[model samples]
Target: MNRLFVMMAVLLAGMSAYAQSEKRIYTKAERKSAEERKFQKRMETVMDSINYADAVKALEELDFVLEADRLVFKRGETAFVTSNTNFISLSDDNAVVQIAPFNGGGPNGVGGITVEGRASNIKMKTDKKGNITFSMSVMGAGISATVDLSLPKGTNRASVTVNPNLNSNRITLGGYLLPKERSSVFKGTSF
Candidate 1:
């Protein structure tokens, strides 16, 4: 019985020593690197909460154009615009603008019909902080759309809000706007 007790005590001691030795000890440099990584992660989180107006100010300071050749949506199809004229054309069936003229007399008016050509007006405005507001009116189709964008400095990503004067639905589309150089890459390709 005495010998058995001695063996048990020795075994327990050995196990305790083994467990203590298993603990990892980091070097000073390794500890510093870990701390730096944690600090960087925190900084990124704080940066994401920055105000949009401030971000637009930074873009303005950099003299950046908020308009892109292509406006890519997160859920819907992408829209491509001409660089010089901003003329956009989609397929015949899925065209954004549709026009029809009414000729018959209604409760309000006359039998004469007025026809207007397919003319569109575009107005673009930018604030001092580089935030952009674009409005398009298709007089022939009686369609009006306005887009407000908040752009960050040195980044292609933007927060966009689109309001169409059809019914009363406003859509929030958050996505990246491809730069001029990257726009060419997607020009011929179907995304």
Candidate 2:
């Protein structure tokens, strides 16, 4: 009778240990799954906020304005551009302003005859006129083109002057691009 009692006690102790180990394993898996679910929710919410059509429209209008001066644009062609992205977010008042450069390939099929011009001496500043001046000198194909864009509230004016080198081919650009909408895509959750 004494031997039976001792054996039963040992069995009960082993069962308790097994039960605790199983509970720990399940708790860890549940925690991991909950985290995964939270991440998925944030991702879906972000994907829904992008409006590509609005971005394309904005670029088209800006292009039309640039075109009035006879400057032609080609996708992956005529001119590649880089800009400092200034984001205005209402959620984070103290967020640091991000400066990002935009890279573009000018017209894809290049005839060495159609070398794309590069912008240098680029400057942008606001004046007392509540207007901003965007100025740059473009040089390529043995030619130089200088452009100054004066953007006033509700009005933007550009002064473009070109000097073509001897044997230089005239270049024109045409395209619809949505470079300004890059910020609309959310790559990850921001705190």
Best prediction by TM-score: 1
- What TM-score number comes out for model 2? 0.28
Candidate 1 accuracy as TM-score: 0.33
**Candidate 2: tens digits of C-alpha lDDT, residues 62-181:** 321232212323232334322122121111111111111222222222111122345566565767854545455555543355544544432322322233445333333221222333
What do the candidate models score in CA lDDT, each in turn?
Answer: 0.41, 0.36
In model 2, how large is the Cα lDDT of residue 176? 20
Per-residue lDDT tens digits of candidate 1, residues 1-191? 99999999999999999888866899999999999999998887666545344444433332222223443443666565433222122221121221111233432122211222232344446677654654434333433455455555434456555456565454444444432222221111111
Flag clash pairs in model 2. Answer: 72-172, 72-173, 73-173, 73-174, 76-105, 76-106, 76-107, 76-108, 77-106, 77-107
Give the Cα error of residue 71 in candidate 1, in Å. Answer: 13
For model 1, name the residue pairs that clash.
none
TM agreement with the true structure for every prediction:
0.33, 0.28
Model 1 residue 164 distance off true place after TM-score fit, in angstroms: 1.4
Question: How does residue 36 of candidate 1 score in lDDT?
Answer: 100
